[model samples]
Target: MRNKIFQKLKQGYSHLGLGDDILQAHAEGLVATGLVTDENIDNVVNTQKSFLESLQKANDARATSAATRAKEAARKEFEDAAKAAADEKARKEKEEREHKEKEKEMPDWYKTEKAASDKTIRELLDSIKTMKEGYDTMKDENDRFKVEKAVTERKNLIISKAKELGIPQYRIDEGFAIADDADEAKIGEYLTKVANNTKAQVLPGNRDMFPLADKQPSVENIKSIVDKLCPK
Candidate 1:
């Protein structure tokens, strides 16, 4: 069947080259080696179409594979990114919890140091107040003692200071008598007054220091002794 189609195709081409023969005899048998023929052209067209269809099918499969691989990679990347985000959030939350716990912690030193500092300040203030009270009390006692000594005895120190200033001891005694109130607590007032009035520096036995008697002197008696000793 292929030979019959080849013979017909060759005869058709030979007839195309006839010049003046209205119906000349065609040398169509030579079509078997002719370069131009319908059957061979159609076969080449079919073969090229088949080859193009194969190449297109192969390209379609390669495109599908590339798309599938791209999709799988994209899916894996998205999953990894989600896990990283979750891990980061969890880490931040854990750190915040730890920070809160640290904030709540307290040690013994923190409590005791503050307590000791407060106590020391309080003690120092109390000690300062006590020392001020003691100093004020001592000042009052010392002033009272001075008044009592001047009233109760001839201050040998005063007499000595008076003699250095060329003042007589009698004048010193008279000055002291003027200042003395002769309170009963001062036991030596009367005897000192008597000794000053008599100008007798020495007296007998234990009475030389003007000892207290069993009874306190009356105000009038004390006043009378003072008037005689000073006269003013």
Candidate 2:
């Protein structure tokens, strides 16, 4: 009967997947307690089998709970990682878009400086052009003034020399009209010829017509004659 109980306990514990060492320890403990008997042997086997089944069920429940906890943790980790990656991607895309926008537009400071520089260049060019025009105009006026001064001096010299030669005003006027472009030497020669012609035109016994032909004229007589002939 003891052997039959031992066999039954071994078969039952083995079916419950208990290790050899645990089954041996439990069987030895039951024998030391004097619980195995012909009358209670089947009851002891059934009771031990029932206790082992309840323990296995509790272990399975804990293992199932632990597996569920681990699966939930893994899913949360995956979701958190996915969210972080999406946020990083969005941040990089936003930065790239801002960079592209910056590339399309120039800075305000640079645009303002360039515009000011262009304006200054135009003003400088205009100033230079205006100065050049003013210089040219002044040069032309100066040249015209010099020419007019030279012509006036030449006319004054011719008139003075003609008066000194005692040439008549009418003859001097005719000479001035004909010798408009004559130099000092030509004017002097022309006045000398007119004086000689006046001396040669002295009429015989016409003393009044040739008074100055025989004698050198006084400065006052020449002035009086010139004033009467040429007036103011």
Best by TM-score: 2
TM-score against native, each model: 0.29, 0.41
Best by lDDT: 2
Candidate 2 has which clashing residue pairs, if any? none
What's the lDDT for residue 231 in model 1? 52
lDDT of 1 by residue, 27-144 (tens): 2323443743555654532333444345456767888999999999999999999999999999999999997786558577876786799999999999999999999999999999
Across 1-232, the per-residue lDDT of candidate 2 in tens digits comes to 4457567777767766666666666677778888688888878878886777776678678889999999999999999999999999999999999977875687889778877999999999999999999999999999999999998898789889978887667766775553677777888887788777764454233357435645766566566555644555
Give me the displacement of residue 205 in model 1, in angstroms. Answer: 99
Off by over 4 Å in 1: 1-39, 107-232
CA error at residue 193 for candidate 2, angstroms: 0.8
lDDT of each: 0.55, 0.76
